[model samples]
Every structure is written in structure tokens, then in C-alpha cells.
Target: MDLLKKKIQDEGKVLSESVLKVDSFLNHQIDPILMQKIGEEFAARFADAGITKILTIESSGIAPATMTGLVLGVPVIFARKRKSLTLTDHLYSAEVYSFTKKETSEISVSKDFITSDDVVLMMDDFLANGQAALGLLSIAEQAKAKVAGVGIVIEKGFQNGSSQIRERGFNVESLAIIESLADGQVTFKEEVVSR
Candidate 1:
């Protein structure tokens, strides 16, 4: 997590008070080594949760989710933003609004990948508005799957996403939480150590 924080500090671009672009080493051009480390960390955090599957959205969430699945020895399922001809009609769908894109899209997951008996762990690249995660959660609920927790790579803490998820009674773990991005500066929420 320190490595990730350092990476953000070094290469992350502050586009504005509400946007921090980490495409250099995260979503756009990925760092496998860092992703592996992130996966291992998520696995460690959710080691005893009896996770049967890892759920994520397409594109950005795939890398970290795949790595987490590898480390946890579980299969990864990603929700598709766009429906294709090959995708079957039998799918669980939900509407999600992207904070960055500022548009709404329907995300869907095949019913064959998830089941009522499975314990699912949701993973994402960023948690700003929590819409994507919520959509994934809706899919899981539709499948009657038990959601163990959510693992986020970076959380914009200034947003209400994490709190919304927590209020819904799900455990949310974030690798790096930005408390603020005011004036093109990144500030993180201090980790509280429990004695």
C-alpha cells in the first residue's frame, strides 16, 4: 500500500480538485508487479472470508481483479459495459453512472458465472461515486450470492461512495484513500491503528 501511495505521489496527475489521473501506472499502462502486490494484499485482507469468486467491472477493474483472483485462487468475473452479439440474453444487469465519464451505462454479468452459494468479493480500480460497485452488488444480489466485501485500489474519500457502501452493511477496504484533492493536492485519510 505504501508502494501504491508512493507511486501515486510520484506519477499521478491531478487533473482537478475532483479528478486524479493515474493512467501512467494503473488503469492505462499497468504495472504487473504492483498489481500482484495489490492482489496479495487483498488476498491477505480477505483470507478468511471464504471467497468463492471475485467480481469486478470491465476495463479498469479487470487488472486488479484478475490479480486478486490469482492470489486468492478464485475465478474472476467482470461485468460488461456493452452488450455484444455473443453475450447471451440471460444476464443480470444494472444501471451505473460513471463519475469520470459523467454518463450512465448499463452493466451486465452472465448468470452462469455467479451462483447463490458463492461468496463474492468485489474489486475495482477506483471508488469515487460507488456506482460501479453498486451495480456489481445489484448483480450479486440478483444471483442471490453472498457478498463478503469490497476491495478498492484507490478511493476518493471526499466522495460519499465508501460511506454509502458501508451504510449498506458491507465491508469496504481501500488500498489508498484520498481525503481530499483540493488545489491539485492529494491528502490521504490517516490509518487508525487499533490497539
Candidate 2:
């Protein structure tokens, strides 16, 4: 996680007060070695939950989620933000608001991918208002699947979303949490694991 924090510090950019873009290494062009490390760490953390599947949203979350699935040897299911023609009515759905995009959208997963016996590990690239995680959790609920835990790459700790998710009694782990981004600087939570 120290490596990840350092990567963000070295290459991440703040697009606004709410969006921290890591398009160089995370949200866009990816570094697979680093991604594999991240996947290993996450797998180690949630290894006892008996996870049967990895769930994530489209675009950004796919990389880490897929990495996690590969490491765990489980299937990775990505919820599509943009519905396609091949989608069927047998899908579990939830509406999530994107604080970055400044709008709400529906994220859905095929019912065949998740089932009642599944213990889902939800992963996302960022956690701000918790909308994306909430939507994924909603889908898990609808499927009657148990949420094993949630893993986040970067969490804006100053935001209310992390607290809301914690209040739900789910195990939440974030690699780097920014306490503040004041004065054109990124101030992260001091509890970061030492390298």
C-alpha cells in the first residue's frame, strides 16, 4: 500500500475538489505488476471470507477486480454502466450517483453470475460518496448473497461515504485514505502502512 500511495503522489492529478485522477496508472493506462501486487494484498486480507466471486463496476474497477479474480481463481463480474443490447431481464440492478460525473446511473449484473451462496468481494478504484459501493451492495442484497467485504484503492476519508459503509458493519479496507486535499496539496491519513 505504501507503493500505491507513493505512485499516487508521484503521478496522480487532482481534477477538482472531488476527483483525483490516476489515469496514468489506475483509471486508464494500467501498470500490471502494481495491479498484481494490489490484488495479492486484497486477497490476503479477505482470504478467510470464503469468497466465491469478485464484483465491480465497469471501466475503472475492472482492472483491480479482474486482478483479484485471477489471484483468487474466481470469476469476476463487472456491472455495466452503459446497458447493452445483450442484457437480459434476469439481471440484478441498482442506481448509483457518481459524485465525479455529477449524475446518477444504473449499474447491473447478470443474475447468473451471482447467487445466494456467494460471498462477494467488492472492489472499486475510488471511494468518495459510497454510491458505487452502495449500488454493488444493493445488487448483492437482491441476489441474497453475503457481502464478504469491500476493498478500495483510494478513499477520501473526509467524505461521508466511508463512514456510511462502516456503519453498515461491513469490513472496509482502503489502501490510501486522503484526509484533506487543501491548498493544492494531498494530505493523507497518517495510519498508512510503512514501507
Candidate 3:
């Protein structure tokens, strides 16, 4: 994921000591090539997990989830932030506090998309507070689905989210881990060579 790490370092902006704005190529105006590469990376990491579905929250997680689905040849199931007209009555929901937006939001997914027979690989653009991931995990649990793993594009290592998820005993992999964003500087964990 050197390409992504380099792109972030070159174009990403440090909004504050706690935020790294990668809108230039990640969250906003995305680079399709990089996204495909990221998808492949996630697939490779979780290849042995026998993933049957790719789960993600709506908005930021869509692109990454779609790519993962495409690469892994699995269906991408995203949880909607709000109840929509197209949604069915049978659903699994969880409340999550978004640290970035400083607000609480509920994410929901139809029970039909998840089942006890499936193994889910959760993907996301960022992992800060880990609330979103927790919410997804909750939904998976309700459906009795086995969680294969968690794949994050960028994890804020300074935050407690990643550690919290790890403590729960599930495998969590992050492409780029930010050690800190202090002093208006963005520092990332040394790039890991994908095996």
C-alpha cells in the first residue's frame, strides 16, 4: 500500500492534531486505481478467512466495500444510516457515536443480507473511535453471522478504537496506521508488506 501511503503523505492535509483530511484522493475525489488496489489488498489479507460477504456502513464505506466485493467475488452489504423506504421491516440496527462528526447516528442493515451461514469481512475508510465497526459487529451478531475479519483503509493508531476491537478477539487489519497527527504533522506507521 505504498502508493496510498505516498498519496496521503503528498496530498493529504492535517486538519488538526486529531484529523487527517485525505479528501483529495480518498474520502472525496477518489482515485479508482488506488481504490482497486486497496480492494485487492483487503481481499488478499482476508483471503484465507473464507469471506462470504463484504459488510460496510453507508457513505464512506461504500466504495471500499464495493471494491472488496468485486475482488472477492462476494456481495457487498452496506448498512444505511437511516431507515429508508426501500428497507424492509426486518432489520438489525445499532447506535454509534461518530467521533469525527461529534454526533450519534444509527446504522441499519436488512436481516436478509446477513445470516448464520455467512462469514463477513467488514471494510471502512477510516477507523478512529471504532463505533461504526462496533455497530456493524452488533448487526452481524444479531444475524448470527461469523465475522471473518475487519479491514480498514486508514486507522488512527493514536485513538483507542483499533485496540478496543482487537481486545474483542477478532482479527483487525489496517492498511495505513497513523501513529500521530500532532503538531500539524501526519505520521503513519511504517508500511507493512502485504504477504
Output the number of the lDDT-best candidate.
Answer: 1
lDDT per residue for candidate 1 within 1-195, as digits (tens), equals: 789999999999999899999998888999999999999999999999999999999898999999999999999999889633345489998889876787778889888999999999999999998998999999999999999999999999999999999999999999999998988888889987422
**Model 2 TM:** 0.93
Pairs in clash, predicted candidate 3: none
Model 3: CA > 4 A from native:
83-88, 191-194
lDDT of 3 at 152: 96
User: Candidate 2 residues 43-140, lDDT tens each?
Assistant: 88888889999999988888888888888889999998853334559999888887667777888999989999999999999998999999999999
Provide the TM-score for each candidate, comma-separated: 0.95, 0.93, 0.94
Q: Number of the top candidate by TM-score?
A: 1
| lDDT for 22 (candidate 1) | 98
Against the unseen true structure, what C-alpha lDDT does each candidate score? 0.92, 0.88, 0.87
Over 1-195, each residue of candidate 3 has an lDDT whose tens digit, in order, gives 777788888998998888899887778788888889999988888989999999998788888889889999999998989533345479888888876677787788888899999999988899998999999999899899999989999999989889889999889899889998988887888765657
Candidate 2: which stretches are off by over 4 Å?
83-88, 192-195
